[model samples]
Target: MEILADQTPLPDAIDERLRSQLTFVIEVDRLKTVLRQSPLAAAPRRENDAEHSWHLAMMVVLLAEHSDEPIDVGHTIRLVLVHDLVEIYAGDTPLYSASTDQQEREEAAADRLFGLLPPDQAVAMRALWDEFEARVTPEARFAKAMDRLQPLLLNWMARGGTWKSPGVTADVVRARKAVIGEASSALWEAGQVLIDEGERRGWSRSGS
Candidate 1:
């Protein structure tokens, strides 16, 4: 008797768009342009787009214990994680970098990056992404605030200032924190203490 032969046959390949899940590879490569860790950390030191997103995601989890407004932690976390994908196209702006045309440039970059998805997803992602960009809603505003707050916290603890490396002042730190603090008063209060201490100790680029 002849040995039985296997009759397995491969299924037809699925196209990228046809599958329920879509690939947004375009955004992935472009994301390399975004920088994190700020100029204060390495003088030109920067974390990649992926690292920056993860840092925000972790902050949502770590800082949850400190939020006072009964925020939707889940949504807040999600908001932070996805907010910065625009950097892939627009690149990360220096915290204190001045620009009259920055907003328009970022909006265009967002359109290109988020527009890569299929129609429905394009709309959904673009909406959430825009929410983070606009910082109007509670979620967007809170997440945006934290976005700035986290890095500042690090620089403060390290006795460094990314913006200060150029010409940032104590007032500038206060102003940057103001936008984020407005989103969550409690977070703002907690952050203020850090700023005060930073100033008291002369926590500039030296972190001393």
Candidate 2:
């Protein structure tokens, strides 16, 4: 028996608008290759930017009620989903490491990546990404909270996840998660419990 294949002619009807959108769709697939420091909850392997974004999006839905202020959950979800798309070019910077140049690099990545879409979509996506970074709007704040929370939750679940790294200390975790309290005191409390537990269990380094 011969192997069968569907031979189809090229559809010339596709236009530049759609071609640009498709190009962007293909380009963003690279986000899966941008590895992050946080490990997956279900496994030991490090998570990637794509997985991190989807995880935060789901977390926003699951934990929306915990936000201290009323937020547009839909808009918040959009923020989480697109917030890290720039990492496709800039790569994931470890949460514990601070780099003065990180924001500039990510801004350039955002400009190039979002620029792949049509003008209106490019503008909308860029705005969402920027809003999340700015953390000014209620939705942005809540989205930022969830983005911080998800990795912490994963670390807790994975028994210290990235906290085992040499430079990661309890103080570092506390400082990094401070924004969670600003958005959701309830979620912040929950994160505190995990941090305390991690310290107790030796999953995180304690202050000497």
Candidate 3:
């Protein structure tokens, strides 16, 4: 039996624009190496930035109806997917860990990583990331809600996975959940149920 080879060389006629886009695509694969504090729902190992972003994108699709304001689902999905590409360079910062310079580091990483694409594409992606960070637009708000919700669901599924961390308190969890409420009151109510359950189980600290 002959074995089929899967690898293929790039076309000789590929343009510089396509080359740049492909370069950016290959570079972002590094996001798989940037692990997060939140573990997978059923797996013992932590999820990487790539997995987290993909999960959030799916959540945007499934939960868009819960958003308080109407949102452009495609744009919201774009925000979640591109929001964490900076982590490919800046690295993941655990939610409970203090990092005074995290914003500065991530901003620099965004500049360098996003710059790898064609000019127009780079600007467009960078704008999505910026909009997500700003959290002012309806799509950004809903996207950010899913960003927080994904980990929260994982923690609950893992029986307070990262909530067991030393510095993570019920107050901290509630504070984070506030963003969910800003996006969707129904989602916030659901999150509060999990928070209450976590508190009862003693998986989360009671006070701030």
Q: What is the clash count for each candidate, in the order shown?
A: 3, 0, 0
TM-score for every candidate vs. truth? Answer: 0.79, 0.91, 0.93
Off by over 4 Å in 2: 1-12
lDDT per residue for candidate 3 within 57-105, as digits (tens), equals: 9999999999999999999999999999998878888877878988999
- Give the runs in model 3 whose Cα sits over 4 Å from its true position: 1-13
Q: What tens digits encode model 2's per-residue C-alpha lDDT throughout 1-208?
A: 1101113322458787887777787778788889998888788698989898898888888899988889888889999989999988887888888677899999999988888889999999999999999999989999988888989988888888788887879888998898999899999998999999899999999983
Which model scores highest in TM-score? Answer: 3
TM-score of 3: 0.93
Q: What residue pairs clash in candidate 1, if any at all?
A: 31-88, 145-180, 159-207
lDDT of 1 at 54: 75
On TM-score, the stronger of 2 and 3 is 3
Locate the minimum summed-lDDT window of 10 residues in model 1: 1-10
In terms of lDDT, model 2 sits at: 0.86
Q: What are the clashing pairs of model 3?
A: none
lDDT of 1 by residue, 1-208 (tens): 1111112322338565543233464335445656664533445465676766777888887776665456777887778777777776666776777867767777887787666667787788778877787777676777887787878766764676563566676677878678866666777887777877777777643232
Q: Candidate 3 clash total?
A: 0
lDDT, candidate 3, residue 3? 11
Q: What is the C-alpha RMSD of each candidate to the true structure, in Å?
A: 9.2, 5.5, 5.1
